[model samples]
Target: MPPIFRAPRYLGASAIAGRGALPYLACVITHARWTSQRWFASVLIAMVVLIAVATVVGAEMLSRTTEVSNRLNDRIAPARTAVAELTAAVVGQETGVRGYVLSGEQQFLDPYAQGRGDETRLVAQLRGLLEGHSDALADLDAVERRMASWRETAAEPLVRARRSDSYNVALVTQSKEAFDDVREPLAGLDSKLAALRAEGRADLNDSRRLRNTAFAGLVVALLVLIASIAVLLRVVVLRPLNELSAEVRRVAGGDFDHRVAPRGPADLAVLAADVEAMRGKLADSLAASRQQAAELHRSNADLEQFAYVASHDLQEPLRKVASFCQMLQRRYAGQLDDRAQQYIGFAVDGATRMQQLINDLLAFSRIGRMYDDREPVDLDEVVGRVEDTLALAIEETGAEIVRPKLPTVPGDATLMTQLWQNLLGNAIKFRRPDVPPRVTVTVTEDAEKYTFAVADNGIGIDAEFADKIFVIFQRLHPRDVYSGTGIGLAICKKIVEHHGGQIRLDTSYTDGARIEFSLTK
Candidate 1:
């Protein structure tokens, strides 16, 4: 197929896709604009980045802090180890002295020699530990001097007592007392250094805790920022877009009068201005069009009235001329030849039929010309009057008219009566000879209108001739076959239309015809 022929399908598909995608796209754009205005969104993102950076920095700081702590801890370990060794040396020295006093053995002197050697090592270790702090170094110096004096004083007495093979208890007791003095002061110095080491560990723990708290606070700030951004986007962007969409839907659904106020970002202001301009243009164009339509309607009404009056006036003269001609033909037939009489009769018949046709045209034209006054008309009563007028026709045709209960409607009573009379009479007149006319009138009511249906079992019109039947002088059958002026249905159409209603053929065939009309209730 040619692309041109496929154009309509492509256009329809494109329109459908556009309609489907527009709402989603609008929502996305609205959300994006909202996000742009969200202070918290930007803040949240920045905070997250900052928190990540801080986390790295804090981790590095923690590592360095821990290293410092470890170095401090390492310094304390050796001093503590040396203090323990010296205390053991003091105990061994005391035991050795006691052993010499009791056994007089030279093997006991071995401990005394080891103790003297350990005394020098202990002093050197203590000095190394106290190298950085003056107060701690002073305390270590005091402890060292006491240790040297006690060792010097206590060891000489013990050696002399052992060499003489006479162990002096008093001298040994004095030596033990001096050794206690040295040990007690050394233990006090060790306690002070141990307290300092504990303080350093506590500082390390505090630093680590502070770093963790900083990171946690940063994370919390980031979370709060993100939440704030989300709220801003919803209020600033989504809300305005939704309002615009609702207004647009109203406009699409034939409410072109609707207007949307500009809101949200600056971009929407331009759109709102354009929409308002379009609305104004449409309103102006509609007003001008309505004015033109009113003028045309007035001209049509004038034309109809003129035609009705002209035709009605012509009908009386034409009727009289036909009646006189017919009288002359009947009265003077004996004096004239057969051909002359026949021609006169034909002229009279043509004039009489033209008169009838003119009268029908006048009736059709006068449907709503002088009958604008509307009053409540009982359709049932109208139907009864039509039945009375058509009683002889109905009897002759053996037609049965069936009607449902009808309602009172606002319309010209005379026109409503005529409307029913013409429709019902047509049904009876257009009956098939072999079958009795079965005409039924049904009524249906709605909120604003009432529908009246007149169905017939008769010589129904062809589908092609259905609309033609309503036009003036347009006949489906010859005058000899169907006696009609051919303006009945046309009058019915005009009457219904004048009352703000419509009339149409519901169904029609050679055997039957159903006609329906509606009027405002």
Candidate 2:
């Protein structure tokens, strides 16, 4: 046999690998898409969650800041009023002392007492209001110090003058100068407190701006992520898989010549390569098988032609020798000696056997030439015809032919007739002398082929020669014991083989010989 061209195995493996990889890659891609979608969705959800959190936090912070600012603003005004009240009280005390000293009126003394009391209470309240803040506290301390200096240097001196009876008018002027000297410091302290409040408001505004900017950035980033994921899925997963699917459809349609173009990632590229290799190998294998079949057909035709010409040419010489030998025996048998007659008889028998061999060769060649014309042939009718032809031999041997119902097969009528004749003849010829020949013909059919069996109770062949008996010119018996052209079984083999079928023999000492053949249905 030609080296079993391991190409099919390689192609089969490649095809299997290619087909298997496609689904694997598809599963991978599907999982990737689902996972990627989930990831994108999760990121978006996380972003939204963060945005919500940030929004809530920012709103709370802004609300709190606004509330604090409003509270600060409200406190600033109250603090400013307190400072103004304290300043007014200090100024009034100075004016009252100056008036008492310069106008010599006791009524101004009441004003001084009222101013001192109010100034003391206003300074205490201002200090309480500024308690928590060092900056505000420093401003309050400056105002307090300035008021104390004004009371000591201006109010007390003017009051002393009024009590001393010297009543100097210069003292009243000196007290007014002292009040003006303290006014600048108290105003500077109030200005510093206002600046601090302004800085706090600026910080709160900056915080709100930062929160808005962060939220906007988060939204943009999430949108970009979603868009990127969509693009990735389309490019990497969906498009490549669609291409693979199209290639698979083409292959299914019997276009094994098409090659898949490599695309996508590493695994998909490998799959495409495998598919291409499979197509190449399959095409090569199919081409080789076609060439092999064509060569085999040519060989068979040549053998059949040779067999027909050779057998026809051989028959003419054998016929002349047999006819001449028989004529000599009939014309001169009495004059000839026993030895001469025996030699002449031997020539006749040899010639006759040679003629039979040539005829068997012709029949064997005809078996190969016969083609299935596919007309219905009733096998039962064929068997009956064979029985009629072999009637004399059957009666002589007392052979009993048992034929079961045989199916009608699509076959050539003449070839099937010849087939039954040869098998039935073999059955009668090889029978045991004491036991009557019992021959049985049966048939069975399956979806694709039909089997026919011809069984006989005869002197069976040895197991060793069973297969050899179907070869041309192969014989198992001596000429004296049994006579045959040795091509009968070979012809049967050829006929079965020509019909895309096979033949075999079953033999045993007790059961005799059974010939079985199968033909395509």
Candidate 3:
């Protein structure tokens, strides 16, 4: 396979060995995590570049817009104003010349002199305004020449003739013709200025439109980029994560046969591969565990059946042995020696104890298959019955059993009774001589179950024997000292376990032996 297609190595030995989900998850994350980081970084950089480019384009557009505004404000508008002023000055000259030629009055001469002064000032201003405009400068020169001709050839000569009292009608006609010649050029200059102003306005409009377009494009690009990021996040991250979460839930729901397929980006795909691998290993482990448990259960069932049958069968022989031994002891009491009578007594006691041991074993084995009609058993009622049964022992030992109101729990009535009977009997039997057996049974209830503590102010069990005491036939005291088959607490353990609760010696209790157990409520 190509390098890109090759599988990633796990970070730890456990991951490579396909152990539990934790290592697999860690390995998958380590393998596939950074691809998303790089992807995000690339997108961010692209956005930055796009913003920078848009900014540059917008700046250039704004600069062009400003240049257009300056052209209209500074060049075209002022030049047009200068052209209008010059035209008015030339018109005034024509007006003055016509007046002098017609009346030859001194006031008309004053008007003529004023027109010349106005012309000089306006011409200088127009020249300055049109300094860089070659076409406007040519137009200004033509106007200047036309005005000079009218002033010198027509107005000046006619004015001189009239002053000397030699002015004629022909001179007046010539001056009028010269003044009319100036009108055409002034009209041309007006058209030129109007065209320049219109062109400046058009250029300004185009620049503004360009700037608007650039801004609109920038906005559209940013919107598109944001939308793209949202889409990418959904596709590459959210969707895959949701799918993976659902897959995990299915696995958690005990669907060991369910498989996770590789999907999404390379990293997520690798993660999926790791999860699938873990799932397969877990499925195998669960299958093996279930197989072992089934075999163990069958073996225990067979053992229990054998024990029940053997103990039931042995009881007849044990009874015969004890009866025959007692008959011998009674019938031959005087005839036999004291040693012979003691031997027979020992045999009887041995037979009786063996029978009791067999009976205890039978009871223990029956715990597995006996309780078929399980229901809610009230511990208070069960403890009351236990107290009744152990009334003789409690009275003889002067035991004070303090049992508070107890919660009702789901269990078998017979088994619950047996459990309490065994525990209370032990408390009564194992009392300290100095103190009356003060056995207190209390219950604490929580959401899931009820925890019961049977405490007694008796000789407490040693810490080393806490766990040992719950095993069948495991007794801390000798049979003569405790007078039991050593299976009472073991029976309690079995019953609690069968009901899906735990029974343990409360090692934390220092004053006495506190046996705590729980039952599903």
Candidate 4:
């Protein structure tokens, strides 16, 4: 099937982030010329693509921020604290050495021993903290060398000289100058750790800002997309629908002349056009139906007048001719020649047949029109009456009639009786030579109706003549041979149709003639 809505082709997988996607979508939206499906798809695809990209970017930024925060809190901060404590430990060692040299107190050596222990532990811990950091580890190595050299050459010598009572001022000055070398490296290490902490905090702040900006932009884009969809729907779907609905209402409110103009998307426009076409057809049909109803009313009036004439005027003349011919026949039976007798017989037969034709025609026309006294007509009783009416024919033909226990149906008793009578009489009349006819009436029922089949074992009708046998006056054999006006099946057709049913020949029944019909249950 052809595509109906014809949404934009760019709203596909390959076009999710295609360069032309946004431009084309924007153009259509700006021009207000898109179908609902196209606009919806375009907007939806744009939203999904942008949101996906934003989410991925935001996640990366968030991860970066978390890494930076961890470095600042765990590595950089702890390394700075260790450097500061190491600087304080070296200062304590210098102070203790100077105090011991000045006063020769043994207790002043305690701070020197404690500071040495702190320096060793701090150097190891800081080395671990700055293991992978080349610049920080270089600065930490320099600080450790300076502190260890100061402890071995300056601090240890000063403590020993003060303990031996030979600590001079020059020696104290030399120790203080050596301690300044340790301070210099410690300061450089402290400065390097401080720079690292500052850089980590800056990276963390930048990552957080970027992540927040990405999320905010995504939210804003979502709001814009939703608003755009709403606007597009209002312009492309809702307005047209409202207009179409109004037009439909106008047409339905007895304004058949109102034309439904096409609007909106291609699908909606097609729908509107179809509705308009239907309206035109309905209007034309209504006018034609009214005209035909009027003609039919006139035709029915003429038919009633014709029926009156055929019943009274035509029947009277026919009876007179038949009666006068019989009288002449009785009077001049031996006097007239055989040719004259034959001519007279022909006239009488023609008049009698003409009367039959008129009666049959009148009966056919009067069905369902003359009366409507519908009731539950027992088909079994109707068949029994028909059998009684054709009792002499049945006896002579020795026809066997097999019938099931029939059900009651809704119809006029007289019409139902005529229906069976005509069918049964035809079966009896059409018997094969020297063959006793066998007729079976069977019934099957369903939810809505009962189907009946009347099958007769006689000269079966050909499949080609199945439709022809039901037409009025359409006889297959000569009048003398079949003895019917050929209106029997036609009358049956009318009677069945009048009762809201259908009758047709069962051509598949090759062994005999079969008639199947259905009636509403």
Candidate 5:
């Protein structure tokens, strides 16, 4: 590598750490243009860019380190070994030549012969390994030149003289000097190879360090990214969402005037505006409903007052007319003609029927209107009172009232008694001719509620008129057939409903009419 381009070859951990995103993030977060979408998107893109850069740089560093390691293993180390082998070969040649000269034996020439071949092969191998390395090649060339000079000027001459008994001490000393020349270059060549190996290892170490620092930076950046995302969500969404939810809950808790004001984004603010508008509408509707309820309560009070006053006022005139007519019938019994007696009779009957109508009307109107009594009323006792009230009818019609031991219910005792009397009286009144009425009163229970079923074996009400029967003044039978104001079932319905119960005719009961009603425990 050129020195000019290798200025920052090994940027250390601090270089990577210094370029971290914290400073940039602080600037970005405080920017007015940094919104939720932009914050997340920019951070995500930055993260992806960081990861890609780290991956590419790490891979390049690993490849470069591997290349240098391979050079040390496959080139520099082998070249060094070749250089060492060449040096050993040179020493062997010097020793073999000296030994052959001293002993004047031809067998002593073997190592010299073998050493020349080894040295030639090693030089060629080292040249091949150090092909692109000028320093190593220059060292190899010096060693080769010196070895050739020794082979020509010392080794050959010494061996030749030993064969002829012409080798002298002066010639041996000159040959030894030539051998030192070869040894010097061999040492230089070995040192040069070692330097190359050391450089390759150093390059490998630097690459590994750079790669490690890059990956560390990536890890730190990942953590920073996660923290940034959390901050963005907390600031942009979660906190605002919590505030909005609290405002909505407050409005729902009957603080209808608490305005919903949302922050953060335009979309969220628009949604809050919609909610506030709805709250306004709801508040207006609530106020209107309260006004109507107060008006309805006053109207109901006025109607109750009118009903109480009207019944009392009308009862007096009907009673006096009825009384005077009865007196007339008794006093003029012989003097009066048949038509006159019938006229008096009609007057008395009309007055009596009018009085009965007014009484039934008063009773029906009083139900669920004036009473505030709530007590545990023994229904069995209520049924007993109803039986006594209808004793004459029950005995005349020979009706059988079968009942279980009824459970006590929370309600007005008078209202409950009236309920039973109306139901039982209807059963007895509407009995089939020549068929004794059989009324069964039974109570069934469920979780948190009781269902009381009063069934009667009599002329049952028609399915079509089942709903109409419970309406005030609604009668299915003619006036001549069923003689009473038709408000009994309506009163029973009002009583049951006032106690938070429901009363309905069981159309499924084929044997007779069954009135089913429910009361919560």
Candidate 6:
């Protein structure tokens, strides 16, 4: 409370607040560096790397297996088939040679000619197939030598002897021995080629099995990687967002007292800190608002007290002045000049009006004072009573008050009655000279409030004076034309507002003045 401390106290408080925020500020700094964006990028990069590595390994394994299978199917199997065909060709040639030697006919030599061409083609194919296998190629070369020697020594001799008419049994016996030699080497080569085919088939099966295993392993690895990424994303991103959403809902529900705690990833923590800062500002603003409201309430109470005192204490003096002026007017009317009489009349009228003004001001000031019990007051009853209170005016002006059955609402009954009385009286008082005053009071109910409209076929208030008409002492017409303290609408406004509702002129009514008000039900 000392002078020097008081001025600089706020500075110390602000320093303390800044210090309090340092932890959150540090958290924000850490959050930016360790952001969720970085986390997602890392996961994505790792996934891509894993996929690349797996793809490379799988592709390599598949390539090697495919190559082995292709070698067995395309090269080794076809080579064995070629070797078998070569053996068959040699046998066919020897059979044709024997037929020609036994029958001494040239027609039997036709098979030998065809077999010779087939034998050459088969040998060439076998050599090409065995190119990479040195052991197999050596066997193929020995078979080829035997085939050439047999063709030179047996087949050519038999065919020439049969065609020249010099073929004999002795020549036939030599051809048989040559064919026997050829058959022995051809049989050996066939056996070796069969074994190679068997080995190739076995290797092909193994290669296929290995390829299937690698493919299955690759698929499983991909599934596991996808699952891990999904779990990581849910834990690192989705769960944090869900928690932040819940905290946001709590703050929106007006629980500003409970600060949101930092949660999940660094980014979420930063968001929570920012929300907490906003909550702090809102709490401070609310506190300041409450303080200002308290000050305003006190000021209104003081003003009300002043108005009450002035109205109550000054009434007797105003009454005496009015009474003396009336007495002077009645007792010495002829003795006074016309100007003196007019001055006296002015004083009397002024005092009476002043008294009326004070009374009206007091009534206006007393609105919203919680002295009476608030209970459910039926509008039907309130309107009925207000009608009776203005029965004389209604009769004089022939005003028709068409009011429907209305709902009951909560309010001080006397105040509700006064509110209706003032509205109905004004409607009758402000009737247009050309038209007979017609008033309609209707009620509409909603869940929270009842809207009661009092419309009259009278001289309606202009749109420009709609707001001004509710102000105290604000009149649209001269006092001589429409007699009133000009506090009727203002009093109605206060009463409606005191009951936690609003009263306004319905500008949509073009035929006449329509005043609408609401009361909580």
Q: What tens digits encode model 4's per-residue C-alpha lDDT throughout 1-521?
A: 23223245647755633333433433343344455677689989999999899988988998899899988888888888888888888888888878788888888888888998998999899988887888888888887888778878888888888778887788777877888887777778788888888888788888988888889999999999999989989977899899999999999998987777667875566667667777878878888998999999999999999999999999999999999998999999999999999999999999999999999999999998895568999988889989999999999989999998899999889989889999898888888889999999999999888999999988889999989988998989998888868899999999998888999999889878999989876
Which is superior by TM-score, 3 or 4? 3
Worst 10 residues of 3 by lDDT: 1-10
User: What value of lDDT does candidate 4 attain over all alpha carbons?
Assistant: 0.84
What digit string (tens of lDDT, one per residue) describes model 3 on residues 1-521?
12323234544554444445444454555565555557677788989999999999989989988987887788778777766776776777777767776777777777667777877887788777667767767777888898899888988898889789898888888988888888777777778778877887888899899899999998999898888889988987789878988998999898988877555666776777778877888899999999999999999889877886667777788889999999888888889998898899899999998988888887887785767457888878888888999998888888898877887888789999999999888877887876889999888888898898999988999999989999998888887787887899999999999998999999999888999999887
Worst 10 residues of 6 by lDDT: 1-10
Residues 1-521, candidate 5: write the lDDT tens digits: 12111113465545423323223322332342344566678889988998898889889888988888888898998888887788888788888888888888787788888998998899889888888988778877887888788879888888888788788888898898887877776777778777888888898888889888888988998999889889978977788778888999999998987867535544454455567667778988999999999999999889877786768878889999999999999999999999999999999989998888888888877786666478898888888888998999999999999999988888888888888888889888888889999999888898777898888888887788889989998888888898987888998898888888899999989888999988766
Where model 6 places Cα greater than 4 Å from the true spot, the runs are 1-32, 52-65, 102-108, 127-135, 158-210, 242-257, 261-263, 296-381, 403-416, 432-435, 440-453, 457-463, 477-482, 495-512, 516-521
Quote the RMSD, in angstroms, for model 1.
Answer: 11.2
lDDT leader:
4
Evaluate model 6: give its lDDT.
0.80
Q: Is 3 or 4 the stronger prediction by lDDT?
A: 4
Candidate 1: tens digits of C-alpha lDDT, residues 1-521: 11211223435566533334333334443554443335445666787787788878788868867875875666676777777888777678777877877788889978877986896788787787768767667767776777677767876777786788676777788888887777766777778778877877777777777778877877777677777667666865677677777777777687766655445554453354455556656766878888988997998788776676667667677778888888888898789998998888788888888878776766776677667678999888888988999999888878899888889999898898888988998888888877889998898888899888888988787777768878877778888898877888888888889999988886533448889889997
- Mark the regions of model 3 whose C-alpha exceeds 4 Å error after superposition: 1-52, 96-132, 148-181, 201-259, 314-317, 330-335, 365-369, 372-374, 445-451, 461-468, 494-512, 516-521
1 or 2, which is superior by TM-score? 1
Stretches of candidate 2 exceeding 4 Å from the true structure: 1-272, 275-301, 321-340, 443-452, 500-502, 507-509, 518-521
| lDDT, model 4, position 345 | 99
Better of 4 and 6 by TM-score: 6
For each candidate, the alpha-carbon lDDT, in order, equals 0.75, 0.75, 0.81, 0.84, 0.81, 0.80
* Steric clash pairs (candidate 3): none
lDDT for model 1? 0.75
Sort by TM-score, best first. 5, 3, 6, 4, 1, 2
Off by over 4 Å in 1: 1-270, 273-281, 304-378, 407-415, 442-453, 493-511, 516-521
Give the TM-scores of the predictions, in the order they appear. Answer: 0.55, 0.51, 0.76, 0.72, 0.80, 0.75
Model 6 lDDT, residue 223, Cα: 86
Worst 10 residues of 5 by lDDT: 1-10
